[model samples]
Target: MLHNFAGNIEMYGILDAIASGPIEALTSENSTMVGVGMSMEGIEQNPIVYDLMSEMAFQHKKVDVKAWIELYIARRYGRSSPLIRDAWNILYHTVYNCTDEAYEKNRDVIVAFPDVNPSLISSPLEMYPHYGKPTSRRAILREKKNAYEQPHLWYSTSEVIKALELFIASGKELSASNTYGYDLVDLTRQSLAKYANELFLKIIDAYKFKDVDKVTSLSQKFLDLVEDMDTLLACHDGFLLGPWLESAKQLAQNEEEEKQFEWNARTQITMWFDNTEEEASLLRDYGNKYWSGLLRDYYGPRAAVYFKILIESVENGEDFRLHKWRREWIKLTNNWQSSRKLFQVKSSGNAVSISRSLYNKYLRSES
Candidate 1:
């Protein structure tokens, strides 16, 4: 909710703009009240953004977004200062500003399989055999390029970093505010995760040059960054994967039902659909999470396998066995889905302290 405020507002703004012409075309005789169909609720798992949207929707007249943001700050934090204003203002224009056609959500590259040239195949007829036409397959690939594979950031990274710094600086004033702490951890998590993508891109470039030493170093850094991200998320219950899995299990009336439901939840985030060696699931890693336990336990090991294969190929001067690698990776994924390992449902550690530790470790150098 706090993380995706910009995307929620973007949907509102886009609909509002589209309705403007139709609204103006109506004459004095036309008594039709055309309200844009906007949903104030989402599956964000946090209500702060939804609460703000609900307030805006309750207004019987046109809403001023800027004014609403101020009210939100006051209502959410119980008080406001220039530091808080500056931070949120930066967020409003940068990270939270989603006027472009790029993905509405931030891309988590840590879970994505590593490749020398990481992208959706332009010609995925073989990859998506279900699609008959080449053009149709290409269209799917294009959409996936923006939404899933190789996601791009629409905002300036430096501006968001500055905003995070300001957000952390306001901690002294917002110490007692629990909401502030949540946002702090979320902002920190996003900033670091974005950097992980940058690291991934660098690793790809290193692999291209066959620089084994650089690849080795960058791969370790990438893994370490993911481990730290898992640590940050573990501090907040909102970001854990445990409760979501547990809830899925608890909904079952019998053991068989429990197993099926658990499988469904696990498969959605991982494979998404059944696939064989002849046909692969293009939606793999599409529903990846930045949740605790998921990072260290799942995504990290998967990436490690890819890195190991990449290093071996680079050193041996042999071509990458894409087919063999895919088979092994899919097997690993399938095995994890069947395992009955229970994750920690409750959160631990202080959000503010962990965020500060991460900021000092990761973002301080950038500042």
Candidate 2:
């Protein structure tokens, strides 16, 4: 995100003066919120600008509105032009008062034009503050009730699907030129090849027979097939396939590729803890290689806490430690528990002693 705030600050001051309100009230002190709102405003005004900003925002997780406006004006007009500030002011006022009525009135013009003032697309909903002084529990519950009582603004599932179909059809029609058709075909092929290779590897891994020779032979054949597919992919000189084919070819040639591939393919393997020696042995082997390393690298100080849970599960011979270490890992990673749950190894034991020791180690490390 761009941080050139000079323009925004000047704009905000002017806005504050017009309203005769505190300047700080017009602008958020929170940098992230300000950036998000400004970026969204910038995008809504111009679809081309919106497309670029949205892509950058989704990838980089932030946007600088002032810098973007400055660059945008310089590109469209000229560098160090006075009209830049004037145009920005006009756009700002338009966006500041943007409402549902305005959107309805201007919808046709916005859809038909390449350049749009951001205000034309602004939604009042986006202006709502995300955070502020804490409210009482009762007030919060009341707010929730009021929200639920209001008509739902989001599209239903079926409506969304229909909308997506329309979008795809429109995109295809718009890009029906020979050049674009070739690009689309190459993109589709590359995407299919990538998915197919991933699915093939997954199928091979799912067969748990410890026959190393068979697995190795099948893996080698799969790799060869992938290489051949990539070779065919390279014949398509479209932009979409060029980058993907190049990457796949590099992967095929690189000797150290396997290690990188292994890392990419690393997935959690869940084992239910049974007190049997056989279960213990399997758990130890798998845990040491995959689970232990993941926890240490990702969780750092809390790694030992996860390790303790694994040990405890095994010692107790319990069918499963419900939630257990895998749950904590999900919390730390802030990801869905689905993948982590797959790797859950359930074992029975209230290994308080082990947990205590690990907790102490974590504390010491933190200190």
- Show pairs that collide, candidate 1: none
lDDT of 1 by residue, 24-76 (tens): 43333665745424342335533444554445434554555566667778888
Give candidate 1 regions above 4 Å deviation: 1-42, 45-49, 103-106, 114-148
After superposition, candidate 2 runs with Cα above 4 Å error: 1-51, 54-179, 182-186, 193-197, 203-208, 211-221, 235-367
Residue 100 lDDT (model 1): 58
Q: Enumerate clash totals for all models, in the order shown.
A: 0, 16
lDDT of 2 at 301: 26
Q: After superposition, how far is residue 95 of candidate 1 from its true place, in Å?
A: 1.6
How do all models score by TM-score?
0.80, 0.21
Model 2, CA-based lDDT? 0.28
* Model 1, backbone clash pairs (residues 3+ apart or across chains), number: 0
State the displacement of the C-alpha of residue 72, model 1, in Å, after optimal TM-score superposition.
Answer: 0.7
Candidate 1, run of 10 with poorest lDDT? 5-14
